[model samples]
Target: MKLRMKSLAVVMGLLVLPGCQNMEAVSPWIDVGNQVVKNAGYDTDSKLARGIKETLYTSTDRASTGLSQVGAFNLSLPSAARPVADGLRQFGLGSYVDQLQDAMNRGAEQAVAEAAPVFKQAITGMTVNDALGIVRGSDTAATDYFRRQTEAALRLRYQPIVEENLRKTGFYEQYKGLLAAYEKLPVAGKPELDLERYVIDQSMAKLFTRIGEEETLIRKDPVARGSLLIGQVFGGAEG
Candidate 1:
């Protein structure tokens, strides 16, 4: 009876061992398991949402800063306007072309810097279904989600800034000058372009591209996961 009692006491002590003993190493999974139902993928919806939001926050910040630099949006003239641009280049009026391209890039760079708040708002407002789809879907799922949710708003926000910056940079006058020179040449087609819309569209596309790259990095590179919650949620860290 004494031996049995002693063994029972040892088992009880082991059972009551504090959960905090290796908490730094164990807490992430513990928190996950408490709320998760252990699906094949094994993540709580809330944790998944939090992890994705964190990832987007990091992605947006990095992309915005990187894309806001000089020459960051080194976009070419629109394809529709290519003939016009080529004609100007042939006529030795290339300075107008250079000035116009530079102005578009400058406007895009300035407008992209304002995108973080819009991205954050979209991340904050994602639905449970949206989070789940992002976690289980393609590599660019989060980027796609951002596009769907915030593209219109981002375009609306970006247009005025881009227009203002373009005006400040004399893009309109340079573009008109380029067109006038191109019209004087024997360019085959009268190339039409919505210059401001083109700039906004190109900038948004590049911004999404950067964001997609970040999402791919976060999913593939453990170092890019950036937090215990993200690692456990996305990287399958079992407790």
Candidate 2:
């Protein structure tokens, strides 16, 4: 589907506002939009579902694309493994550590690509009941629903891609070499971590964060009300 980039770009800009981040701020836009749809000879249920799905697609597209860039994941070695990482750096092997960090982030970036199809399928499956509930629900209601529908499936799909990218980036080899170096240290503690699982989990968490931000923008940002139907469904009621 063709994304309405003009609309989504406005929504993205609105997200930078502190007030737009308030998940508890209520607005009557959705109700007004619903009324408008009702009066426009459009079936409220179908229009609501389509509008939400279209919005979600734009949101998910932005999230996935933004996250695919290098350094986008912004994660580091877990705290438990920090000592080991520090030790590696102390031995002038810090570049290796940096490489591993970049690899993990890159892996996660690649893994995020899996989310698009999953979200598309999930959004496509959205029920009229789901649409009604989301329209009447909290600011993040749509995001919450999207998460419930896609989280498990996303995890299952993200892991292998993450693992593959990690290997491609030589993270495993560098990690093992670092661990070998750390073992030679006179330290009594060995830091253990599941890097693959960590990347998968963090990637999913960040993906949801992006989606939630978009959902909130749609609910609260007047500029996000782009299309005629979208504006009608999300615009404020002129009292």
- Each candidate structure's TM-score, on Cα atoms with residue i matched to residue i, is 0.72, 0.73
Error of 1 at 213 (Å): 0.9
Candidate 2 least-lDDT 10 residues: 11-20
lDDT of each: 0.71, 0.69
- Please, what are the lDDT tens digits per residue for candidate 1 over residues 1-239? 67655543343233222322333444454444434343333335666687778878877788889999997877888888788789999999888788778878898998999898898889889887777666655667788888899998999889988777667655577666776786688767666576788899899999999988987777665334556555554554332
Over 1-239, each residue of candidate 2 has an lDDT whose tens digit, in order, gives 12444443333233222232332343244344445545544355676576667667777787788898777878898788799789988999998778777878888988897678888899888898787667666666788898999988988888888777667665567765776787687877656467877788888889889877876776565345434444434553211
Model 2 segments more than 4 A misplaced: 1-42, 169-192, 222-226, 237-239
Model 1, residue 55: C-alpha shift (Å): 1.3
